[model samples]
Target: MAKARLMVVEDEAITAEDIRSSLEGMGYDVVAVAATGEEALRIAEKLKPDLVLMDIVLKGGHSGIATAGELRRRFSVPAVYLTAYADPATLAQAKLAEPLGFLTKPFNEADLRASVEMALYKAGAEAERQELIRKLQEALDKVKVLSGLIPICASCKQVRNDKGFWQSVENYITEHSEADFTHGICPACAKKLYPEYFDQLYGKGSGGTPE
Candidate 1:
């Protein structure tokens, strides 16, 4: 498997450096680092990193959560919040962004490794699920247009579908396709079958009435 590409976004220089070092040591790419939300967005658009470790507080007007939300909506990248505080209000705000993971500050190298690994795994699983659903939908579409061997009788217009069964045209169509049938009389059949009733239904010599 390829190593996960990571972007570190922290306002504190020393903490960012330490995290970068730890991530590199754990075999992650550590593709880019940003001190502000704007820088993070620029690097993310360029690098398209697989995951982002973003500090909740940043140097610019846009917070890390805001940047992460934009990345997710536009690029569909997964992010984990790196913060020193985990108060309920802050955590609730972070949760609204749908972060992959949360890591409190003063964490060790092992903690960072575990958190990153779990976030990448979760992202991978979600992507796999989406791909599976797409493939299933495609298969269903193919099945819709599949032309099977349908048996038909020479005398009557009825057809024999799969399973060696005989049924009316409407019944066979409704069973094989996602179609709903409504009963109605065509102009030719209505005029031939019910001329007197048709005149009674509508005015005299009117075309016909629907069944």
Candidate 2:
């Protein structure tokens, strides 16, 4: 199997080198290393790495969270944050970006490997789920088209189906679709079908009065 491609974004030179070494040791292919958020975004778009290891605090105005958000929203790239700070406020902000994982700084090789593997697996599972839902919706749409349908009669409130069978409107609709029927009166239908009863309950000028 091919190695999972990764892009590392860290401004600290020593930290970046250490992360690159650790990721390579874990059998991931480090496609590119970027010290700034802008460079990270550019490399991510062009190279299309399988995952991004981003440091939350960066040199430029665009922080790791901002870059990760852009990558996810625009290119659909999965990202895991590698940060020194894990304060509640920072974590809350990070949650808004929807990172696959967050690893605090000074992490060992085991933490690095585990976080990366879990992030990739989560991303893969989500993609599979979306594809399955899409296929199910397509199948349902085909079923609707294959089933015979009928138009309702305006005067009698009945349906004339393709088989030349005339049925009650509700019965015809319920047969062909997933709709659950609940018997209730719409204001206009109530007024038209039971005019005397409507007038008795609510008086002449009420909006529910028959047309």
Q: What is the Å distance of residue 96 in model 2 from its true position?
A: 0.6
lDDT tens digits by residue: candidate 2, 87-176: 999999998889999999889989999999999999989989989999999988756432544577889989887788889977776777
Candidate 2: segments with Cα more than 4 A from true spot? 145-211
For residues 43-125, write the lDDT of model 1, one tens digit per residue: 88899999999999888888999999998988888899999889999999999889999999889988888999999999999
The number of residue pairs in model 2 that clash at the backbone is 0
Assess each prediction's global lDDT (C-alpha) against the native: 0.88, 0.89
Question: Would you estimate the TM-scores of all the predictions?
Answer: 0.70, 0.70
Clashes of each: 0, 0
